[model samples]
Target: MADGAGRRVDPDVDLRVPRDRREVAAHPAAVLGAIAAGGVLGALARAGLQAAFPHGPATFAWATFGVNVSGCLLIGVLMAVLRAAGGGPPLARPFLGVGVLGGFTTFSTYAVDVHAALVAGAPATALAYLAATVVGALFAVWAGDTLTGRLLSRGAR
Candidate 1:
């Protein structure tokens, strides 16, 4: 097959690889292993944070909020760097992005925290936490992406 620029393309080749090189597909086991290892570390870190800063249902879930926001920011930065660097090893995204960040950021816990707040007769706190987390995460991602892009572009020049 030929790409839009009229270069020959191998259908079996991993798109992440340059066309001039032989495509080396990552073994499924390796990918899964990376994810699992990263997940363990991420989950442990999150658990430690939660344990260190336990919060009642009626109060703000600062630990979860911090973890989620930082995770979002890290993901944005990681993605930008990966794109700018033309990607990385096949295991990089699976290990760091999906596994680690996915594990570290707890949407399920966020939901539970919100539910607990509501159940504790703190509807206003629940609503506030929900809005803050969503908005803060979005803004953090945007900030990280923008900052990384700018820095990378400057270094390129």
Candidate 2:
């Protein structure tokens, strides 16, 4: 059978098939460790950015916007590379794609920023920021995906 990307599926290695608990735990431990390490790095980077560009309720949160948009873009590129390569090292997805990006993107912070803006009598700014962040992140992700896919396709040729 083939997956959504048309990659051949190995039935023997399928997750749907029941496996020994020990076997599953042993392999996933390393991937979890990689994710934990990557998460630390990603979170620290995000914290540094937030610290350097601290914004108040009345001010626009440029730092959070940049982080979320850039994270989205990088995720798009990462996904493209992983797909193009039929997936990379086992830990690569868990580490970079999940742990790093997950840690870096701040949905909770975004929500708080919007709430703060509204509370500070900047409803327009809050609405604008919300719209811009969502639209910008979507566009960035699309651009990253297209660009990476094209580059990889050309390299393949």
Candidate 3:
């Protein structure tokens, strides 16, 4: 298969080395376990990121917004690659989606952001974030589907 640089690699075996990238071909069980592990780590990381930046009261949830958007992007890529390969989820989907991304990006925090925006009479910001999150996440999902659909079809042919 070709890599990001269009370099060829063996197709018979997975040679991905990065611990994170290894999930690209990791055993189903290991993938699930890693997701479980990543979940704990992501949760702790979220708390840490939130606590480390305590400058603003209710107006600054940039961390949550950033995390959610980033999570959406990462999941989009991972989900595309995995599902493109027709891989089983057993743990992959749950680990990445439910465990890691979900933990990293707290909807509770998002709700707080929305509530604060309204309380501060900035309904536009709140509405925007809500619309952005929903629309952006859905776009990410669709993008993943489109890319993966193409990849899978190519592989099939």
Best model per TM-score: 2
Better of 1 and 3 by lDDT: 1
Give all candidate RMSDs, comma-separated.
6.1, 5.0, 10.0
lDDT tens per residue, model 2, 1-157: 1223323232113343233123337687876787788888889999999999999897889999999999989988887887787665666766887678878888999999999999999999899999999999999988988999999999999
Could you arrange the candidates by TM-score from highest to lowest? 2, 1, 3
Q: What C-alpha lDDT do the candidate models reach, one value each?
A: 0.79, 0.78, 0.64
Each prediction's TM-score versus the true structure: 0.84, 0.85, 0.61
Mind sharing the TM-score for model 3? 0.61
State the weakest 10-residue window (summed lDDT) of model 1. Answer: 3-12
Error of 1 at 119 (Å): 0.7
For candidate 1, the per-residue lDDT at 33 reads: 80
lDDT of candidate 1?
0.79
Itemize residue pairs with steric clashes in candidate 1: none
Q: What is the lDDT of residue 13 in candidate 1?
A: 29
Error of 2 at 98 (Å): 0.5
Off by over 4 Å in 1: 1-26
Which parts of model 2 have CA positions greater than 4 angstroms off? 1-26
Q: What pairs collide in candidate 2?
A: none
* Residue 55 lDDT, candidate 3, scale 0-100: 31
